[model samples]
Target: MRKLGCKPAVTRHNQPRLSGLRMMARKAPARLVRDHIDPAPLMLANDQIGDCTSVGIANHLRATASLAGYQIDVSTGDAVRFYSESTGYRPANAESDQGGIEVDVLGIAGRDGYHLDHGTYYPLWGTVDPQDRNALALVVAGMGCAYLGVQLAAADQAPGVWDTDRTGDNTPGSWGGHCLLLWDYTGLGDNDLVTLLTWGVRQKATWQWLHSRIMEAHGIIWPQMVLPSGFYPTGPDLDMLKADNAAFLMGNLWQVPVTS
Candidate 1:
């Protein structure tokens, strides 16, 4: 059985919303995935503990690095350590294994930094409009991935394409909250609109399912990292994004106008 460990996102008064930024003009691909590197999932100990939040973070960074033409692995043990470091989950004390909040963890990662195999990578993380699919495609295409928190339904227990249920059993959070990493997405018109990583496996779910179940979505960028040759991102301006994140952390609400 897979364990869900993501708590509802902590709301900040002036959370940095990516939709407010001026994004690139190029069209996002109808489908995108970093599977060329064939990165495998580590499960990150989610089978036994509620550390999906940390697992999602580890997986996202691994996928991003793979897309950039190198491999940096996040083992199950590493993820467990991260969960303890981030959420204070202890292996011996199950009571300390309580779930984590996505935004709070992301904020910490951005402020402190995440230690991967290469070194500590400081990420600029922020929320995005969960209701906007076009914006989501654009974000994922550019960043190589995004992190999602969903209210799981009972229907999620059975493995197949996760979709809505008509029997009133698909109510959000009916099962619990789970965190997923969005690494690939098909077009908005497709039934299985996105490919996400959860429980150390790839799962496909409809956009409608995502729209209804998603409580929060976030995007992360590593401005200090450079991509491999031939990979171009159609995302936000790094400079403006940095400014906005700084303002968000400092308790100031500053909106940079989208320039032409």
Candidate 2:
């Protein structure tokens, strides 16, 4: 797990600002997944030191705007600056330095307004229950993406490979606190794998790994963005339906129904 650390103060550089343009929200597709989301136009969160937090936020903002038919690329350097301004932390002195918090990154989004070619994005804060897979799935399915702070083990840091089978025994060791963007979820039950946007690529992690490694999770709710076109029942949703059907059947209502 990566522990949070502030970057040392340094000379700041000029960065691009968000455009104040706004666009109309269009209806989303009936379903979405890693494959369903075209990766081409989406901005990649580069692998930089002490900047995972900014990358995560930038990716989320870009994805939200893209879904609404807009092209928006949030500058990671600007995001870092925003983080510094909001939290009173010094700018990163080096590329490998570790720093940032989810709240501060979100504060920047709220303050400046996430602008896009089509429209601006407004994020709604929501709790992330990593232990509750169904809840996580619902947020991702309904909201498009979730931001997560995870403790990564050595095995978890393997580049270009699906990180699975992580356990609690794996210590953070020298790894510092890190953040990333959760874009999609696939499969069900014990086979579930979360698709995360990190290091400029989409990575995978099993539910087991996520439950064990995730220290904090937050849903980036974009009110201006449209929800999925169709309903996708989650584990709890299915369970509730099953319970309702059983209750109705046990009441013997079907045997008595014919009034119409």
Candidate 3:
């Protein structure tokens, strides 16, 4: 939160300025850190980590999908905000400010397998924090897509402080995300052959692998159902899904589409 009537001395890139006052106040000039941010200014810390501007996501997805020659329509939004003031819709949402993500191909059926529609690995744009209604959640059951969910870490489940079992993460050798494989019947010899993308204790992978990783890291597995539902092959029974970015997806979990 910038304050009114406060200005810092201008800075030049040729020379690095040092200041004891800056260290005390912990403030950097706008010109200094402005370009360091992704996409644009006023885009960070206001929303959650993953709550990035939809424009950045859309552009990335659009270009990538186009290059791949796939029929994809990008929605990159939450379904709830696309409400009608005059219809049966209300203007209230628990995760409304949830930012947008890349949608590889919109309006296409995806069930069996899929190629990357569009997205990038910008970590600042991928962290998930609850924006109440601005945050988004999704559901798709009885299909063939990976499932993802996001939930706030328990109080004790933070870094540098935790109990033996309930202290750390769900994935053993991973961080920046977590994952769970509800079923694994697709991949290899005697091993259920599937994986998922998660963000709790570890990143995306098979359920067993993610779970084991989490246990080793944090000493406990977050109780199932504590995380928000991420994705599915089938969509919710809402008309907005056919429309625009009405899905209201923010930091909450989601899935790769399996329009089989």
Quote each prediction's TM-score. 0.86, 0.63, 0.22
**How much does candidate 2 score in TM-score?**
0.63
Q: lDDT-based ranking, best first?
A: 1, 2, 3
* Tens digits of per-residue lDDT for model 2, 57-122: 667766665555664655655555544443444533443243655554554555455554445555
Which has the better TM-score: candidate 1, or candidate 2?
1
- Higher-ranked by lDDT: 1 or 2: 1
Tens-digit per-residue lDDT, 119-215, candidate 1: 7777786677877776677778777677899998987787778888644489889999999977786667637567887887778888888888998
Backbone clash count for every predicted candidate, in the order shown: 0, 11, 51
* Candidate 2 runs further than 4 Å off: 1-32, 39-46, 89-98, 111-121, 164-169, 172-174, 227-260
What CA RMSD would candidate 2 show? Answer: 16.8
lDDT values, one for every candidate:
0.74, 0.51, 0.22
Off by over 4 Å in 1: 24-27, 33-37, 166-168, 228-236, 252-260
After superposition on all CA atoms, what RMSD does each candidate show versus the true structure?
6.8, 16.8, 22.3
Error of 2 at 209 (Å): 1.0
Ordered from best to worst TM-score, the candidate numbers read 1, 2, 3
Q: What tens-digit string does per-residue lDDT give for candidate 3 at 1-260?
A: 21111011122121111111111122211111111212111221212323222222232333223223432343423212111110112234323332222221111111111122342121101111212111111110111111222222332235332222444454322222211212222332222222221111112223233223331110001111121222211132112221222222221223432211
How accurate locally is residue 256 in candidate 2, as Cα lDDT from 0 to 100?
A: 13
